[model samples]
Target: MSSDDPPYLMALPDPVGAGKQKFQLCMSELLQLVRVHLPGRMAGAGPSEREQRIALRKALGYLDSDYLIDLPEPFFGALLRAAVYDPDPSFNRQFVEPLRVAFGARRTQEALLEVLRTGTNQERAGAARAWYWATLEMVEDIQVRWDQAALREFVVNEDIDVRRCLLPQLPLHPSHYPGELHPLVAEAVHIGRTHPDEYLRHRVELQVRTGI
Candidate 1:
């Protein structure tokens, strides 16, 4: 829907009032009571994939229009953090799959990007973690570039996540990351991307794609 469309074109609601209060409350409740322990529960898949999918779909639908949309999916981001830092390879697929199915292709790509740019820490981290898995699925599909200028600009983004996200895909070779102050940039990029919150990711990645 275009901004020019009537209902769709309305101004952003007050985040603390008409807009995101409901979402924030929902997140607080879920994080404190529900999602806080999903990873541990996720140790086994037989619990009910179908049921899980249904709940996730419902959650995403509600959060889509919320200013705090990304808060509810913190567990998914944890999975991505594991993928980025955890050494395990085979079993983590369980954590990653539910995340991809719920948030990957199903949710609007634009929604993910929107959170990456402006959402809160929970929102951004959740989205970034989801995005890492999402991007990994399509990594091979990314257009390769010999354009040094474009890649350099991207690798140096002020937003940690943007830089970090683009990093795994950029110049694809470790040798490409420079050896000097570049390591500092790499470390900063790593911390920002791996942060517990996604807003940090949004900021990091922006540094590469645009400016802080």
Candidate 2:
């Protein structure tokens, strides 16, 4: 895999296999929760719970063809959580895109930011992955806010996964931060540059070279 690619993209089996298993477990739990909280939602899947689980897994955990806009408030919230906490970043959009279509771009971004700020390391990493899709447009204020939050988290979060996920989204340039906070950006850049993950290192190198 190229340096810019996520570590999970490597041919190695352990990370990829483990991630897939985690994702499957998450989907199963989400399906059960949905059935309890939104009875009859899975009725079309068939009466047997095994059939319903299989159907939901095939459907990527979305119950119907409505893209989830028709789902009630609590279920939608649960879906958003599942999306941002999903271990496999590639599959997160299945849940995230529907929420974006239903909730609008700004709200989606705000929700992701909230997760980045407060979630566990895994969820924070997932939020960083989902942020790419959440930012459907260029809103300067929101972009700045997200950059700041991401940078702050990157500096303090020692989790390699979180750092790898956040690196691509951070504004590595010092100018993006206020004078007092410029050091924070510099520190983040240093961390990225020296990080053991080649993806993080290469991303920071490219950003520095391109001044992006």
lDDT tens readout by residue for model 2, 1-212? 46676333222111222354455555666677667755554545665545744555444334344645555565556557767666656666667766676666787788888889988777788788888877765456778888889988999998877887787767788877888889998898898788887777777877776665
Report lDDT per candidate: 0.40, 0.69
Best by lDDT: 2
* Candidate 2: worst-modelled 10 consecutive residues by lDDT: 9-18
Q: How do the residues 1-212 of candidate 1 rate in per-residue lDDT, one tens digit apiece?
A: 34454331212111121223433343333333334543333222222534543444344332243422343466455434332222222322344454455556334334455554555433443344444444445533222221132244344444443333333333423354445535555665675577765544545554444332
Superposed model 2: Cα runs more than 4 Å off: 1-22, 29-68
C-alpha TM-scores of all predictions: 0.29, 0.72
